[model samples]
Target chain A: MIAVAQPTTAWYLILAALLFSIGTVGVMVRRNPLVMFMCIELMLNAVNLSFVALARDLGDIKGQTTVFFVMVVAAAEVVVGLGIIVAILRRRPNATADDMAELKG
Target chain B: MELFVFVLASAMILGGAVGVIVRNHPVHSALSLVLTLFGVAVMFVSLEAHFLAAVQVIVYAGAIVVLFLFVIMLLGVDQSENLMVEPIPVQRPLALIVGVGLAGVLVTAIVQARSAVQTGTGAGLDNATQTGDHDSNVRQIARSLFSDYVFAFELVSVLLVVAVVGTVLLSRRPARLPDDIGATR
Candidate 1:
């Protein structure tokens, strides 16, 4: 009988780092506000994965409980973010992030 | 079994992430994000964070992605953008370079220090068995949340209410056009 080594905590952390980098690239390269928003969601999920992994490693329930708070915050952020996107699109149809230069001084 | 599940979930997560970035249409990107979210939920379950896995599916895949689709439909910006067109020159290349660099640094750090970090402490699973109570993960989480972290929990509720109000105020459309302002008077 052969014993297979299980995946380690470091593997989870590495996966999270990879996911975070992907989200960062998406946010930078994608022009659409909605897509950028989705990328942000991806980034948040990656962070949540890290939290859960650490919680499991450390035997702490706090980390898992914190995931709940993070989820709530993420939901709120999506609502407000999408509302802003909708408002912008309502006034200017098919507006990309580049077109919103009104904030540039 | 665990190693196989981890590999499968990680592949799904990374594939979905790439899909979200590479897809030209917003709807496709949103669907890809759902895949990524589900993969994360699966990872949570494998980590023994069952409560978080459930919440990830319910709140993220269920509610948050629905909100994303709602806005995508309402805005009607489903048309695919030109991938070849670069509104900002050098943005894509720069992002790729930076992303690859970041991933390299992280992976290198983990590889170098892998042995120092302990694995399989089993504290999470131990909490349930050591006491002989056979309490579920959710119950343990509830005990910590309601007792030790009660104040922060209440604050999150308040933040949610504020977010709801802000979204309503921000998305409200004008009842009448500006040109109608003078005609009625």
Candidate 2:
């Protein structure tokens, strides 16, 4: 009977949860570093979505501000991560994550 | 209308996320990520965080995704990956199990804590109390950012500079030592 009800905060939270889970799976299963990095971005965006939803539900601006900070941090993270990835891939083109075990010794 | 937008955006987000993982090519995954980021931006608009919506588009979709594509092209690693060559036999199944468990736990927690999200006594997030002043969302965010969060804002700027310098050092080729050059000459 709830045909056209607006999405509640809980709906957004659940969606975020699902997205985070997918990202986690991608990071775990994918061997390519670039794909794993994208998965991390997915997880970050999921967290941002939940933060915005809760901010609206609680009538708080702090949550949005926190999301902004999170975005900034994520950008920095991506920059550093991709730089490392580019360096590694440059040394051995098309190297998988498993091949980066040279430092294990 | 709201429900439609929510459902459509959720579909975009989930589909793009799945595509990112399932696609064989890194370029495909990167494009899928763009889809997911845009969907998140749409969700931001639906949540009435208009300024964040704009930023989500600009910073995430515009800047970040383009950077990702640039890396892919620059590296020339756009070849399709082999998804079937699993060195660890149980890794994929184990990851799936872990992901499912995480989603289950989070959904349960959200459902249990649903009643805790009562409307607070914070300032209202309305738009345009007077004519032609329709930027209340951005205005309030700016006030908060410049006031209580100014110190953190400055720290983030510092972090960005460090990241930039570190990336330059990390990605660039190391300079040849003078002795090595003399020996080669």
Candidate 3:
């Protein structure tokens, strides 16, 4: 039977890195806080992907286990983050990250 | 088959990420984020992490994205934003440069470590390393989580409780000023 080579672990790692970089750029350049939060989610997912890939490659359950903890942390972060964003919006309607420069001093 | 699925999932992931950043409306960005989350879930399934894939869809795409949409609607900021405006003079250029540099570094590291990663000593004895007793992935994970990582698991629960309290505290409105004092101001 003819065999096909599966995609390498490096390929998954590279894709995760690319996704992480994109998320980083999005966070850096976006003026909207909500968009920035989405970028953070993208970054978390990227990390989760890499973790799963490594787990599969090494045949370890630890990596898969870590992804669960990471998800929990990400969920907590989103809750706190969106709450802060909502609070900011209440104080100043239509505020962007640029308008949040009151603490610049 | 695996390669095809990876390519499709990665395309959806990256495209959704780009959509999240480039879309003018926050609501559109939220929807794009949903796509990215679903794509990640697909990737999880491809990696044989079925439990994580289920949680990714349920918690991320369901609860988290719904929370985001609720905030977007509550704030009434769904109107399209002016994308041309850049309050920070060099933010976009700097971001692009840094992103490219980071990607290059990561790709280089992965390439250099490819051989070591593939032939490492920790390879599992079987393909289904964690599927003990023919139980599901979720069951095995729960076993390890409660037995070996119980402390960390309990700590996470505590952290979640604290997060809930913090969210409530942060979102509370400030005390209203006296009616008599408000008129003078």
Candidate 4:
């Protein structure tokens, strides 16, 4: 398997999946909005990793294009998302996400 | 050769995942996320997506994490003792059920995705006139963004501006509340 192409993409995909799961757990279990935000970034990166792998595998630039769009979206998302998080922290002084269920009731 | 680097990156990624969840302190969790981003960036490099790798570092590690830490510092007190942020209130059973359900779905999806693998011939990577080899390829990316995706980029700029204004507005305390007699004007 030294000179073989092998199944390298599988490893990347599995890593991405694991990272995605971790991000999900952080989102589900953690209370802090900032931490939640970080988890969201983690999830997005996991997607990005898979996109690159598929891009390389397909030999087309499309997956890279998708990653570029995702990156752009994520950057935009954080700027606005953090701004909202700051706003929330100002009012209730509670940065934990579970207690932020104002819209739930 | 490749296997060694892959192993190193995988270890780092898994360790970072552990730190992000297991750490009690929020600041420590952020540091763990930094580790996670580094691992993802390295993985990006390994994938031969150099540009995406750079973006991962600058955007995630540099910008997003900085904003996260800024929010953490702003919310919590200077000392750790004063930073007793309250825990989230939720039914534990419900949370566990939902989390397990989601994980099951995700694992299934990953396994299905793996079944569709078709290894590349690897030659097409070296030859593409649309995106010329190596250095000039980045320029092609920029050109594509400006020509094809320019409108979306501009929209993002506008969204950021609105966000800035909204954030200022949302955080600002009003001069008076109904119950307050001596609220600052």
Q: What's the TM-score of each model vs. the native?
A: 0.92, 0.93, 0.91, 0.79
Clash pairs detected, candidate 3: none
Error of 2 at A92 (Å): 0.9
Predicted complex 1: CAPRI docking category? medium
> How do these models rank on DockQ, best leading?
1, 2, 3, 4
User: Once all C-alphas are superposed, what RMSD does model 1 give against the true structure?
Assistant: 3.5
In candidate 4, what are the lDDT values of residues B87-155, reduced to their tens digit? 444544455677567767867776887767676643334333445666543554576567877887688
TM-score of 4: 0.79
- Best prediction by DockQ: 1
Ranking by TM-score: 2, 1, 3, 4
Give the lDDT of residue B138 in candidate 4. Answer: 57
Which model scores highest in lDDT?
A: 2
lDDT of 1 by residue, A21-104 (tens): 999999999889899999999899888999888888877788888889989999999998888788777777899888877752
Could you report the Cα RMSD, in angstroms, for every candidate shown?
3.5, 3.5, 3.7, 4.6
Superposition error at A55 for model 3 (Å): 0.4
Candidate 2 residues B1-185, lDDT tens each? 88999999999999999999999999999889999999999999999898999999999999888889999999999999988788899999999999999999999999998887667556656554543578888888999999999999999999999999999978877567433222112
Between candidates 2 and 3, the DockQ winner: 2
What ordering of candidates by lDDT runs from best to worst?
2, 1, 3, 4
Give each model's clash number: 0, 0, 0, 1
Off by over 4 Å in 2: A1-3, B128-132, B177-185
lDDT, residue B15, candidate 3: 94
